[model samples]
Target: MGTTGVRTDRLGLLLAQFDQARETAQVRLTGLSDAEYLWEPVDGCWSIRPREEAVTPRAYGPGAWVIDKGAPEIPASEYAEVARQAAGGMSVAKIAEDWSVSVERVEEVLAHTGEPEPDVVPVTTIAWRLGHLHSGFAGQWEWSFGERRREPRLMVDFAPSADLALERFWAELDRWRESLGAVTEEQLDTVGFSQYPYGSDPDDPFISVLFGANLELIHHMAEIAVLRDLWRARFQLPAH
Candidate 1:
């Protein structure tokens, strides 16, 4: 195949992962409210507050917003931990399909997946991981694709509340998806993002942006899954 064919193949995989992750996270959010959404593991952990003043972005270098009122520096690497490690596998399109099951087969969600559980140590709620991913992903994307991201470093607010944050973040993501669907190869070739500090462009490629979104979605979705299991253990809510 030609270069355009190769790029199109990759973009198709990325968008699928993006949408799949979005659906999984939304499933986690069902029936939850604002007050229930904000609950975290401890006092110092991060959260998206209804008011802007509640959580500062963090002060470090130019364009670096304060995270907490006077919180300490948080490295981009710190986010990678909360962000889901790869679930292990190539992008789905690359995987062999079962003709019998069909492409539409979906898994029913459960409180636990039998993966080893996180230790009982404390930090923040499941939603905080999503917020951290939003900031890190946006900052990295801006630096690479859009412009030179000023430092100490920076983060973006996906939402004021956990209930809304994922939904709001999805809106931005939907635009990106539209860009992928609508932009001609000529446009994408000329219009590129900075994505600096992360990797070299053209060489590094825009697929990384989609990959970041995929990673963020899976991580938070898993965190919510664990939380659901915990909630079940505590309250014994019926599987509905």
Candidate 2:
């Protein structure tokens, strides 16, 4: 295949993944109510709140941003214990028993089959996640293709409420998506196509940048879907 043909094929595959990611995010957001979109199941979970009500004393870096309540970093000892068990060829059930977690939980982490049961863990709300998706698209597009400027759509600006957040998300995402069509094969092959300073743009090829963008979509969609599941379960909604 010629250079253009190869780049087009590569970009086509990434775009397919991008579409699937967006669909999965949309499905997760469907029927998400305003209350649940802003609900914080754990104290200090990063979520969208009113400008005045978004106070978080425990916040680090950006306050009340997309930071979610997270599992405490697992101890090195625990990681070593898992490694030890695996080296011993212990059964998953045995590993679970030794590690003080459910067999299902162990399997979930090992096989990556399911979301962990959301405990009183810190987590971002649907509104916050949606705002993040929009911001990512806008930020990437601006730096990579459009004029690189200091313009940034902050979470608080667009994510005051669930409805408005969703509206902005679609608008920004559509604009970002449409802009991809203008990227030529030569541009895709060129290194430093994006001068976005926050990431690998300084050294990596444009194709790597595209791959990184796809990774953002896939992982964030999965995370949002898990958060949606947790939100539904928090209210004891029937898992339809």
TM-score of each: 0.53, 0.64
lDDT of 1 by residue, 1-240 (tens): 356664345556666677777777666668765555566645665554444345544422222222332333222333232122113332222111311122222111111244433343335555555555555555554554454655314445434355566675666555555656654444334424434453223233455555655776687668877866665466565698
Please name the candidate that would achieve the greatest TM-score relative to the true structure.
2
Global CA lDDT computed for model 2 = 0.63
lDDT tens readout by residue for model 2, 39-126: 7667666765544554554221233343222332323334544555556676777666555567776665565324434444346666
Q: Which portions of model 1 show Cα errors greater than 4 Å?
A: 1-8, 42-44, 49-122, 140-160, 182-192, 196-203, 236-240
Cα lDDT, all candidates: 0.49, 0.63
Residue 84 Cα positional deviation in candidate 1, in Å, after optimal superposition? 20
Off by over 4 Å in 2: 1-8, 54-122, 153-156, 235-240
Candidate 1 structure lDDT? 0.49
- Shift in Å, residue 221, candidate 2: 1.7
Model 1 weakest 10-residue run by lDDT: 102-111
Query: Residue 150 in candidate 2 has what lDDT?
Result: 46
